[model samples]
Target: MGAGFSRRAFLQAALPASSALAFFSTSFRRDSLISAATSTKPQKVIVVGAGLAGLIAAFELMQSGHDVTLLEARMRPGGRIHTMRDQFSDGLYAEAGAYDFTDAYVLLCQRCFLPSR
Candidate 1:
């Protein structure tokens, strides 16, 4: 335990490291691991809601070669992450929900959307 150490940070770093070690060890082959991670037969997936969690889940499923159908009851996506525009007299806008995010959320967004180097 250190000054800034937390369970979240430890798990974040350790999970990937453990998976990498398991796949890259002499017992496993790189090609075999890659093929195993990908689907040989694509399957249809239905994801309820287009919120942040559901959107990310659908994206991941599609990336893994699955056909994903995202359903949202709202008129638009981003379930609770909504902003009201042009509803005020002075043309001011307001956020109805999810206006702010934490450092961990920002990091997760970067990891999800940013291209790997």
Candidate 2:
């Protein structure tokens, strides 16, 4: 353990970023809802894949005055953010693959990381 490497210190650093994510999420949702109510000029835009990146981009484009359509192949959005709600009797759920986000991961998400492209 080096400087500022304890669990408490790690959480102290992470809490603010988590709070920022929550705040940004709520603000974006509110803005999108308000845009739908106020906007008139609609533009056609097709976004394939309903992953986090895709969804965020669509929301931003819509807020920037563009009509957006999302197409997901897995019968639902969330790409790797898959949840299994039927696996337990107590209504507990499990997520696959998506876990433990760090600052670098958030930066990649913000940059719309697509390695193939």
Candidate 3:
């Protein structure tokens, strides 16, 4: 009861009650602990679109021990790389949609933005 009371004596007095409380805490289920401790395969993931954003997400997930698959809407990948020749001038070429990928976007382009090409 004094300020100089020994912690060992206090613990000796309190240990049984604390153990009893732990034994009766049904909220802590045994199965949950078992599942948490068990080793399992990595999560499987699928990316709906092979677009820039989707591809980036897939890359990060795969790096973290998850399996990933990229699904593209169109027959070909490149979400917006629409290149076409001019209507009148056959020699001139143009990009109808999507920004061109640069060196800064190489990894993203290779992993997510561009398809297998």
Best by TM-score: 1
lDDT of 3 by residue, 31-107 (tens): 45335434456777788776655665566667666788889978866566656765648678786665555332576
For all candidates, what are the clash counts? 0, 0, 0
Show where candidate 3 strays beyond 4 Å.
Answer: 1-41, 85-91, 99-117
Summarize candidate 2's per-residue lDDT along 2-117 as a digit string, tens digits. Answer: 77599788889989997998678655554465476457566788987777767766766776778789899898888888887787778788878676554334644566664422
Candidates arranged by TM-score, highest first: 1, 2, 3
Candidate 2 residue runs with Cα over 4 Å from true position: 1-43, 85-92, 100-117
Model 2 — which ten-residue stretch has the worst lDDT? 100-109
Q: Estimate each model's TM-score.
A: 0.51, 0.44, 0.42
RMSD of each: 12.4, 14.0, 22.5
lDDT computed for candidate 3: 0.64
lDDT of each: 0.72, 0.71, 0.64
